[model samples]
Target: MKIQHFTNQLHLLKEDESTTRKGAFIVLSAICLVGCLTFVSLAVDIGYINLVKTRMQNAVDAAALAAAQEITNAVNTAPVGTADVTQYSRDQARIAAKDVASLNDVFIDKQIDVIFGRRSFNESTQEFDVTWNASPSNVVKVIARRDNNDTSAQDGKLKLFFAGVTGDRYSTIVAQAVAYVESRDIVVVHDFSRSMNFDSYFNNESSARLSDSQIEQNLELVWNDLQMPNTGSLAFTPQYLTTTKSDYGVSATVTFKYDDLEVTSAGEIEKVQVKYTDNSYQTFNGLSGNSVNINGSKNIETAWVTARGPSENEPVTVTNNGISVTYAANRKSATMSSPQRIRELYVGFTDNSTDYRSYGSNGPYNASYSSWKEMDYMYLEVLDGRSYWYYFNAPNGGNEVTLQFDDSNWEVKQAFGLTGSYPYPRGSWDGFINHARNYSEFSSRGFRETYGGLTLMNYILRDYPGHWETPDLWKTRHFPFHAIKEGHLLLCDFLEDLGFDDHLGMVSYDTSHRQEKTMYDSDPNVPSVNISSEPITDNYQAIRDLMQYKQAAHYSYATNMGGGLEDGIQMILDNSRAGARRTILLMTDGNTNTMDSGASSSLPHGWDWDELFDYDGDGNSDYYTNSSQRRYVLRTAYDAVQNGITVHTMSVGIDADRNLMRAIAHLAGGHFIDVPGGASVADMESEVEQAFHRIASFVPPAKLMNQD
Candidate 1:
């Protein structure tokens, strides 16, 4: 009975304990289920909020960028020199931003916040600041957001998931951005050195234009005024003739004929050379002429005169020893021009000896020397002036030389040009020496204080550039300024592309852009022709006009980059618009230099002055070069920086002052353009145009700005 009672009590106690364990397990399982559901809700809500936030940021950035692009388009298409940042421009930008922002997916369509303002840099803080305004805005600010207070246009906050949420059921997100276009004012400065045309070539047409009288004028200027010293000279002794037929054919005589002059060709006899069958010949070089002594190893062989000029005029004639010369039958005219020559009478060339052209077989003859007495003459011939530098003027340069002819042979003297008994002071080139002589543009550059004698043409007729000016230099047509001018025009086109307000003006310099006097202010009896202009301007045509009809005519022919930069700076100070970025593009091709300004002018007074100056006009005075000139230039660059101008420098060739240009660019906060030299004019020109475009690209593009 006692054992049964104890077992029943124990079993009852075990049953109660088991029931308690079951209830506890149910409560713990329910809690774990609730915790897992809560974690999933948190993840979904957090991820959705993050995705919405990212989308919002992208929307605003894209909207701001789109708006900025709209403004840029307006600026580019509008006529240049118009009002900047107009209301219509800003309005269009805002519309673009709103349209771009609205397409984005938030909870719903959001109302974007758009604002216009001017953005500028703060010097004190070294940061950009935006000034909000209704007009003249350069910047656009955009804000994209969710959870707007205005329920009608709100992009509602992100909704919570997992069927329900207790508090704060939605999350708001926002993004913002700013973008702008820059306004700028720019100028181009030129280094107008004579050497600027050194590597240039005749790129213009030389055809029907030849028919026009302009051809003659062009020839004169190209062969004279803009002439550059390129060829060296050899010792020459001119041969004289007592009669037109004397002295030239001293041995075995040979006849000569010149190539015909044609509407299409500027032809002349390059040489009247005589050769023997052994190929031995008399060299008739400097100031070439007719009739040569062709005694071959003393054995007379076939001899002929070679007419040379343009390749179009090349023709060969063959004859045994005694050659009867005849001009080509086909000719433009048989007109004997003043100071006649063999080339002047025949108007065309011929290759067919059988069907040859003709016009006065032996060609234009100089006037008759039938008169008996001796007479003096002065024939302007282009002579290489280096040898006579110390003798003439000590070096303002030129090739237009006139000689005091004293060939005792009366016949020869009359055949050339010897009029009445006109007397120039009895001396060779200079009646007396001029210590400081004026020539061409250097009239005011140096004063003639001392006098002496310089016999430039004690002997007449010397060939310069070898072929004389008849047509050698004309055919080569090396005009570098043409390429330079084209480059300038392209820059103007780019300015047109930038839509006007960017503005452009130019000033050229060598010593100074100031043409206070005429280029060849050659006459001292008259007042110097004064030239001046506002430092800068937006008149595109005016700048182009200034460049037109110009070829390195600066007096002293020295480069003064600082003076040019100074002019540019003044242009900005005097003409640039407020809020416009002032900038300059400085171009050059030389070591920096200038003539001394302290020297005064005296001999430019009368014919007495004429007597004082050497015929070739290179007077005695020194060109000064020192560190001060360099400092002056650098100071100009620094002054540019002080006046809020940036100067980008370009050295046009291998020879340009790269260091100085680089220093100037660096000081004024700009770039240095390189000029890897080239062998052809086309290549050099292409580089110049490309450089202009490169700088054009520097006119700051529309960009995203930091909202901060």
Candidate 2:
């Protein structure tokens, strides 16, 4: 029994040992499997995280770049409130990111934030920033921030991979970029019109109806005056008198006259004498008559008597039926002349009617009233050592007119005339000098008051005496006063006065729009004025075709003026060559259409009076030809370009096409602006100042250093 028990125990021990070894092997296999799976998961997750991080980084970068680019384009194209460039930029970023993701076989999710800083005048020192966010699944999150700290600064950040494992994870990436706002050398062309002047009547008080202080500060009144009537007499003369004969023989007439006639005189003259003729042959010797009566007889020949006065030089002879007699001349005869002759000798006076009186000697006339009160008419004469005239009137019923004088008593008129005037001097001398000083001091000062150091340019029309008398006179005599002659000389002598000779060259003439003529119609002395390369039977039809071609040609070849295809080409070329960074501004009425046809691509319709020769039907047809307009544009452009000039063009009250203006701006790499309506003389001056400011900001100070 003992031996069997010992053997069983040994068998049990062997079985126990086998079980233990099997359990140990299973435990080791389970441990190895868990370890291997954990390693594999880590590797895959880390790789994906890195890939996501790179994609997010790229997305952020792209988004930022796109936004920046859009900003630049917006500066060139759209107005402030109307710029929708952000949306387009975001779309571009998404497209780029999507493409990249598709190539990488990874899903990407992105969010962009475009933040715009307040656009202040001092953009350089001010902070302007934009931030963009990019997030991708299992990848990184990137945040890109850009600020106008140092535009040239390169600053960016990137964060890779998520921290949490298994369930959820999060990561962050940061980046920054800095780009400078490109400084542009700009020239702004602006238009001035009646609309700019608040639709005031031309050459009327309404034209310059602003207050004195307002005028003084806001406007550089170039001129103002009365618009005189086309028909009126400056002086008057009397008609000549002659004698006549009658059937009665020697009739004598009585005459009454005064030695002196006064304007205030209301007294009447008394009759002196009368005479008659009869055939009875009766003579009355001593008849000093005060009043006279006439007598007649039947079958009687009449004879007239002659009065006698004192005869110092010669004796008077009276003839009746061939009888002659002499009498002494008297004082009454010496003083007396024929009363009818004396009455007929009166000369007509000036029409000093209440409604028609001159405003200023050279200004627009005030014809608002019908009848003249003594005070209503302006006087060329002075009274009591003062130049006085009516200053105000009641348009309603009051016949009374307020008188103004240039004496101490007339001080009130100055107050009445100069009310609500603008306040400020034109501008700093440095500022004006910086802008080439081509503008008037008054204009500069007015602009400074209204717009604070802004630059502007004014283009006034030249109308000979009318201009000199009206707006010009008003300007000189009133607000921002300047002499008309001096102003004219300043404009005419721009080259010598403003030192623009280096940049602005003489214009060249090329390309005639004239058409070929037939042998029978051709005249060497008088070339064909029509714009045609070849003659056609239908004159109108040929002209139409040529016009279309000319417009097309202008679009293709003459679209640009002073600049190249790139930006600031004109400024760069001109500034470098001329050693001065000055802008050229042109003010015109836009009435010239120099194309083959009297039409423009830029305007709604293209027929301008300045370009047409035969606008009126008066049979006279000498006027500007179609070629003149084109020639002007082309010549201006070519000269400006060749001389390295930045040309800015403005149209005032002209019917020019908008497209043409835009084209001109684009060609010159400049700005095209429309002046606002109801703009006072002050407003126009301010606008010019604004333009100058824009130009100054564009060109670097270094470029202006060499200019004297």
Predicted structure with the largest TM-score when compared to the true one: 1
Q: Candidate 1: where are CA atoms >4 Å away?
A: 1-178, 200-479, 515-538, 554-556, 595-626, 701-708
Clashes in each model (backbone N, CA, C under 3 Å)? Answer: 20, 73
What TM-score would each prediction reach against the true structure?
Answer: 0.43, 0.28
Tens-digit per-residue lDDT, 338-398, candidate 2: 1111111111123333233233333321112122222211112212123332121111121
lDDT of every model, 2 decimals: 0.48, 0.30
**What range of 10 consecutive residues in model 1 has the weakest lDDT sum?**
389-398
**Candidate 1 residue lDDT tens string, 584-611:** 8988877777633642212122213222
